[model samples]
Target: MTRVLNFLRRPFVLDLRALALLRIATAAVVLTDLAIRSTDLEAHYANMGILPLHVLYERNWNAYQVSLHNISGLWQIQALLFLVAAGFATMLLLGYKTRLATVVSWLLLVSLQNRNPIIGQGGDDLLRMLLFWGIFLPWGRMYSTDAGRTEPKPAAYSYFSAATVAYVVQLALVYWCTALLKNAPEWTTEGTAIYYALSLDQVLMPGGRILYQFPEVMRFLTFATYYTELLLPFVLFIPVGVPFWRMLFVVVMYGFHLGISLTLFVGLFFLINMASVLGLLPTPVMDWIDRQVRTRTQRLQPHLTRLSNWRSPVRVNVESSLNLPPKTIQILHGLRNAVVTLLLAYVCWWNLDSIANPSLTMSEPLRWFGYLFRTDQHWGMFAPAVFKDDGWYILDATTPKGRHIDLNRKGRPLTLAKPASVVSLFKNDRWRKYSENYLFVSNAYLRPYYCNYLLRVWNEDSDNAPVRRLDVIYMKEVSLPNYKVATPSREVLCSCETAPPAK
Candidate 1:
């Protein structure tokens, strides 16, 4: 029993340095995500944008959802929250007030995601789960301003606790659950999922254009992709040759997401996915990385020492304020352990329920906790099946002079011809995601907002022709088997008029 327990624990032991890297990478992603979303502050967040506060509350919001961003309609307020989130992210990146910084950062992220979920994708879910698990992990112990004094660095530089177990298990569920959700014939029998995915011209990257030419290669890759997601996650739990497995797992994921980035227009998804596995970098790899950066490390020591000194007084003040008796601290730790355990159980159940597990199901009331913390997730990227519909958007509009134009092309001459690259029609992945969501029958209400926004933005420019009418046209093309292509269909998704010259 003793040997079995020890063996079971090995998979959960994580390198402190790797966790530190995770902290820095996660914080960087948060800041980078903020920067990307900031570019569309008014258009994506404010009342003036495609989704106003009222519309979000009425249509897109969950009952348990909470968003500070939802409290105001002004973009200025949104900007202030963005700045606050950025500041906390920087604190997390530096490991200054590390736990507090992480908590605030997670809260802000959940709030931001709640504000505009339409632009969100699977990567957002992973990032949120990372921060959630991060709250319970001592990831700031090394390569951080909080380092050196928290606890003596273990000889192996490895830490194992309930939190680590939760982290490791959580990472596994991301891929395993995603694979389980992919139950369609495209993934298993037909082996044409990759072909269908690449058929999406709106998301096809430069690499995909060349790769899709080989049908046999695509079929082979589809099986590899499916099995890779399904089986590789199990390797993380293998105790034998643990470090080798961990290293292999990390490398495979790095390559996997790298391949996805090269072939698809998934903004920040690949980067975020790659960052998710950083904590699995084994001790030997970390040691080599440290050796490579030894000189640079030496140069930064002085500054780090100064930072530690600068934070000492703040630390002291905090310790004095909440300095509970030893008994109280012990009880608090026990309570924390209980909470983490419950959360872990809930998350596992949530994933199981998501895939409609035959024997297990979670009660709806229990999901309130997940929604409140934004821990509820669905990793179904192209699951159940790959999307068969692949298309591009055309913002067809008629000018006041009765001349026609395409707002998607900055009011260029209206033509049915597809652009050189359908993927280029989207300004960014957020727009791409929103456009994808816009095609759904349930999201019909979102169409007019996009239509109105496009018309307004296009008409704002003095040089632009004033439009009498505009139509959101989707040139829909379905991916066909045997490398056969479907004829593009012009679907008028939404139509808007420019208020008939202000009545």
Candidate 2:
């Protein structure tokens, strides 16, 4: 038992620099995500948006699932929530009130994600989990405004703790679960997963188009992706040569995500995954980075000194002046540890249960806990099989003047050439996610909502005003070897007419 405890505690001895980097990266990702969502606030968040409050509640209502977003149907309210989320993210970035900032950011992220579950992806899940774990970590031990001012500086590394164990295990489970679920022949025998993924016009980027020309390269990448995911996670457990393996894993995985980012526009998925890998960066790497930064700072010392002299000297201390009694501090620490341990244990159970039975249903208590904390996780990402069908959406509309036009093509006729990047049709990731969901015919509930939303958008626009009717059309392409093309099929999903104002 003692040996087991020690083994589990090993990860807690983390390099503080790595945690600091994680704080910065996570904050940056949060801010970027907020900025992207802000571009189409009404469409993604407001009641008049594609996923109105009524539809969202109807689809996802549960006794335990909660969100501040449900409190208001107004765009202004959602905008306030967005601003509040941004404030928390900014606090996290600056490492001001680091733990409080992490908690607030995580809560806001959960609320926003629950607000429109349809638009969420694996990246959002990973981001939420990271923030959850960040709450228990002393991430502000170094390079943070929350760091001690009176006491001596903290050590470069943190002591081993259960939180660190949870962090490492959670990351490993992501890869392990994803690898186990990918039982498709393409991932094993055919090595065609990458080919099909790149062929998908919806997610494909410019680099993917170029890479599609090389079948052998795609096949190689498919095998590499699967094997790396399947095998690399085991390295985290090896006792000897851990640093070497961990560093190698970080580098390879970071590069893999970079390649994915270039080939596929998966929103913040690549960025969040890359940031998670930063935790595995060995102490030597973190030390080397610090050395490089110090060297650069020394080189620019004169300029920095001049700039510093120009600004008024300000000393802002974060430590509390009223020190609590020893007993009170001990009690608080004990309570915190207990809470963290329980949360980590519950999360572990959920992960193991998911792996044991992908379709397993949680008990009411577990489900409630997951919903309340927004810690629910699903790791099936392109598992079982890669999507064989890929398509683009076209909103066909008829103006009052009797002109038929594709709303996505700036009121041009449907026969006009498709855009080079179909993704450009979406204002943000939320719209892209909704578009992907609408591709499935069985998602009947989304059809009317989306069609009506599109009609409203077109009619509201001065350029395409006085619209008569609108039809949601999907143009689909199936993958073929040697990049062969088949006749595209145009299918109408749903139609809506502009409702005249009440007299």
Candidate 3:
């Protein structure tokens, strides 16, 4: 027990400048989201369909107008929230009043999430949540607006560390639940999970039929994806053998996300998964990043060398004399070595299911698989499926309602007439690689939003058809350069092969 306490109290050290840089980078990314959304505020307001504050108030029989949606009155309040979030984000970047700033930053984030649940989308919310927690930690001890405020503030520091741990735990729980659910026989045996996904609208497709046609390749992909997820636990614990395995797993997972973006019209979901995985990037990768950054700074130093030297000799001497040795840095000294050690262990064990099964369902040990199969949701989104007396079957709805209805039966020509909005946004040259690459393989690769979209498209089509045979052929191609989001050609030709061979 004494040893454990000593370990928790162990001091850890890190470069203050690096933490500051990371803070700025993360803050800039968050700010960019605000900028993008703010520009489209009017359009978003009309389209987002948020639950109005007044509506809630009226429903609850409140007297005063509690609405936050009015253009005249609420606009300023909304702007203030954005400003506060932006201000705290800047303070976080500058390392100023980190403890207070972290709490305020999170409040701003929550306000935004609540304001327009749909428009302000992406894993940025989750990242902000985690960063908010980090803000309370000893993060500001180094590269912060408070970089010089290194005096011991035990209460503040304790709060920050606790927040950070809470964020970590939230991330672990998310991955664990997702991995636990993805295991299933259908995903393993036929690769049906991805096959149904491939026929979605063009935005979600990487390159149309070209990707899905390679049957053998798809099969291998199916196996590899599930297997890697299942083994996450084992790999996380093998300290001696872990480094290589973890690296490989990270690469594979990233590649899978990249594929989803390319093929599907999905990108945000990929970022969310990537954010959680950031916790797994071992210290070495971070060290390498730091080294590269330092080298670049060194290269630029020559330009400012003369100016630096022009400083008074006394100023230089005083600063040099006051510099603290690495061992003497109190923050590093105070880090409980046990906390770091236990944190790593918890990370490995908590999300073990992610390593064991990457999908949102379970497959092996048939006994437990049934429980997973019974669940309908996967990480806040449902799968693209239909109800049957036996079980649920997945379907594609991006094809025309007329033709998609026919394809439900097995072994049909799997062709579709030009869809009105089948083409993917990612497939366009404007976003190009940044868009389609993630959308294409998103479902198989674990891109959350895209997967949700897939599920929605499927479930929406449930009332439409019974299967026979469906083949769609387009009479004319669709082309319209002026429109940002162009739809596919509507001229569809469909036929049923499962019907009796016409005498």
Q: Candidates' TM-scores?
A: 0.94, 0.90, 0.53
TM-score for candidate 2: 0.90
- Cα deviation of 190 in candidate 2 (Å)? 1.9
Q: Higher lDDT: candidate 2 or 3? A: 2
lDDT of 3 by residue, 1-503 (tens): 98765444222222233334445555655576566556534323322212234432333222321223343324455666567678877876565676676666655655454444333333544555456445434545543435443343223211213334444444444444544455555355656545444544434354535676775666676656555554553444343544465466567667867776666554355654554444444445656765676566675666644222211111121223569665655544355434544544443343443334455323344223212211111232112121111111112323333444322223243444333344432223222322223322321232332333333333446664443433332323232222122343443222223324477
lDDT score, candidate 2, position 5: 70
Per-residue CA lDDT of model 1 for 1-503, tens digit only, reads 99999898898899878888898899999999999999999899998889998889889989999999988989999999999999999999988888899999999999999999999999999999999999988777666676534433345677777788888888889999888898999889898888899988889999999989998899999889889999999999898899999999999999999999999999999999999899999989988886766556567767667333211212332323587777877777778778888889989999999999768888877889989988899989899898888878888898777888888887789888878899888878998999999999999989888889888877888888788788999998888888777898999999998776454
All candidates' lDDT scores? 0.86, 0.79, 0.43
lDDT string, candidate 2, 173-237, tens digits: 88888887788898989998888888778888888888988999999999998989889988887
| Native-structure RMSD, model 2 | 3.9
Rank the models by lDDT, top first: 1, 2, 3
The TM-score of predicted model 3 comes to: 0.53
Using TM-score, rank the candidates from best to worst.
Answer: 1, 2, 3
